[model samples]
Target: MKKTILVTGASSGIGRATAKLFQSKGWNVIATMRTPEKETEFTELANVLVTKLDVLDLDTIDSALAQGIDKFGKIDVVLNNAGYGLMGTFESAKRESIIRQFGVNVQGLFDVTQKTLPHFRQNKEGMFINISSVGGRMTFPLMPLYHSTKWAVEGFSESLRWEMAQIGVKVKVIEPGGVATDFGGRSLDLQHNQEFAEYNEFVNAFMKAMAQSMNPETMTKPEQIAEVIFEAATDNSDKLRYRAGADCEQLLGARDKMSDEEFFAMQKQILGL
Candidate 1:
């Protein structure tokens, strides 16, 4: 029988691409989103099972797992890809924004993983793939909220891997850098910033700089990330992290080769300040 894969936030971007790729590969793909109605197209696919799963809802997470097992009999991988980005400086971000960030990105992920652990432990084999970001490893001035959540995921995954090792469970992190997805437009929500307003001209200049630096051709495609995720899900190696995009390569390389100060300087240069 083919292996089974459960993907959260499967309505779009990397999650949708990953689900389709797995279904194409003959895996039983449980493609779940906050609203199954939104994923009418995925339900039409033969190997894909569309289920309702709002990561923020504990009951929905449980229902999704139950449905996955009922449909596929086994879940070999759980891809935690449901998250949003809060784009703005820390001082400008409201308390509610911070709460929402931790609630969805950190708490929701924790709840889902906790709910899945029992099944994986009983089966004695499974994989957990957390979709993190390059910003998790390095940080920028304006994106502190987004960076904090991802950084938390990175730390959480690393620590969880050690505990899961004895049970034949595997944990893998997919860290992608600046992909030209609707993520920038849809995922990010900006907030008030009085101090940064004086820097608005600088901000616009930086935005232009960012646009110029991002290479469309080299930008990590959703399919490319899906491929990496598929490999990570299937492989049983000791490797815990897979950097899956051009920006990831640059960031990881700088982390590996340069001193902290040097890397910071390089980031400053890139911002053209």
Candidate 2:
């Protein structure tokens, strides 16, 4: 009678860590990724069900959920951890990048949650953990679209929580500051805008500074997020959000404690922008 959890983007980093941690805790884990075969880490784990799932693909998402339900009888939690980051100035950002960002970050998460609602309603119990970011609360230069999506998740998850309250379904959002993950590495979409070559040097320096500033240790570990997620899923509390990193704590604190001008000025000073 172990509680079952389905985690998307389970091939690497946060998603991978969350899935593994849940498995270690004896929860039945349906760990899914764009291509599960490409990831050998979860393939051999005990109590982990590796499946292929690309959040952008509707058919694949549905198939994975159906298969998970068949195997586990019920899904106690759904973790929407599948997403990537797009970095560039607003003027330099491409339409396609914006679409892709919203597609996976917002649309994909929405689709997955919608797909699982019937099951949760039927069972009268389930938790949906949506992965947002500290950027949602505070934004930096050249990350407009990325910030927009996470901000959307913040609003969306909160609204969904109220809507689901009567049915015993919980929607929780985890806002982590940059963690030690490839999300800011290989997953970062760093396209140059020759059209804005005027700002090329400035933009390049900014991007490099970002990579340098995001020291993993200064941020949170993926396990920190996993631990927080575990609490959200099992604690049965009324809390609707959890901030999972030191950077998040600082940023949220600043948001609460500082004026708009003070906050923006402090951020610019820290980022050297």
Candidate 3:
């Protein structure tokens, strides 16, 4: 029987690319997003089901999964790719933004995984490919909220694997470095307070450094990350993590070999702080 994969946040970027790639490879795809009505491209695909699934909405999550199982028989893999970055200073972040960062990235992922567990447990085989970030393992200047949630995801997935193994449910994390996506655009919630005059100089320097770093020509493509996700899904290994870009490999490598003070010093030097 042909396999099926369910992807969240499939309206754009990595999720969309992964959904399309899996469909092209003869896998049934449940391409889910907050507003399925706005999607036009995936509607034309043969084995793809574009549906509504806002990670923050439990009802939508349940409905989308049901819709996928109804249309494609069984879901063999689930790619939890629904998340965004909350940038800028954490002190300037609104209470709602802080709550929302954890809600969508951490709580939402937990809900989806918990909801899907029964099905996978009964089937005796399934896989979860979570979209983490290089920030999950390391840190940057202005994205404390975003990095915190990803770090939570990393720890949760790593620990969950042991229990999941008993039921043949595999858990894997994909850590991608800076990608050429709208994450720095519409997907990013930047919080800043001009009233915090003390942070102005540092914030300005950090933003300037970030702008220079986010070169699309040098960053990894969403399609390339999708390819990595596909490999993790089919590799059938006990590997718990997969880094999805050359930058990811480099940064993670440095973190692995360096001490905490050394890594922080390097980061400060790079950001010119």
Please report the candidate that would top lDDT against the real structure.
Answer: 3
Clashing pairs in 3: none
Per-residue C-alpha lDDT of model 2 across residues 36-136, encoded as one tens digit per residue: 77878777877778898888999988999998899888899999999988887778777888899899999999999999999999998899999998888
Regions of candidate 1 where Cα sits further than 4 Å from its true position: 194-201, 214-217
lDDT of 3 at 96: 91
Native-to-model Cα distance after best TM-score fit, residue 201 in candidate 3, in Å: 0.4
Return whichever of 1 and 2 wins on TM-score.
Answer: 2
The residue-by-residue lDDT of candidate 1 on 28-89, one tens digit each, is 99999987986678878897889899887889999999989998899999999988888765
- Residue 258, candidate 2: Cα error in Å is 1.1
Higher-lDDT candidate of 2 and 3: 3
Q: Give the Cα error of residue 263 in candidate 2, in Å.
A: 0.6
For all candidates, what are the clash counts? 0, 0, 0
TM-score of each: 0.94, 0.96, 0.99
Error (Å) of candidate 2 at residue 71 is 0.8
Error (Å) of candidate 1 at residue 230 is 0.9
Write down the RMSD of candidate 1 (Cα, Å).
Answer: 1.6
lDDT of 3 by residue, 184-262 (tens): 9989998999899999999999999999999999999999999999999998798999999999999999999999999
lDDT of the candidates, in the order given = 0.87, 0.88, 0.94
| Best TM-score among the predictions, by candidate number | 3
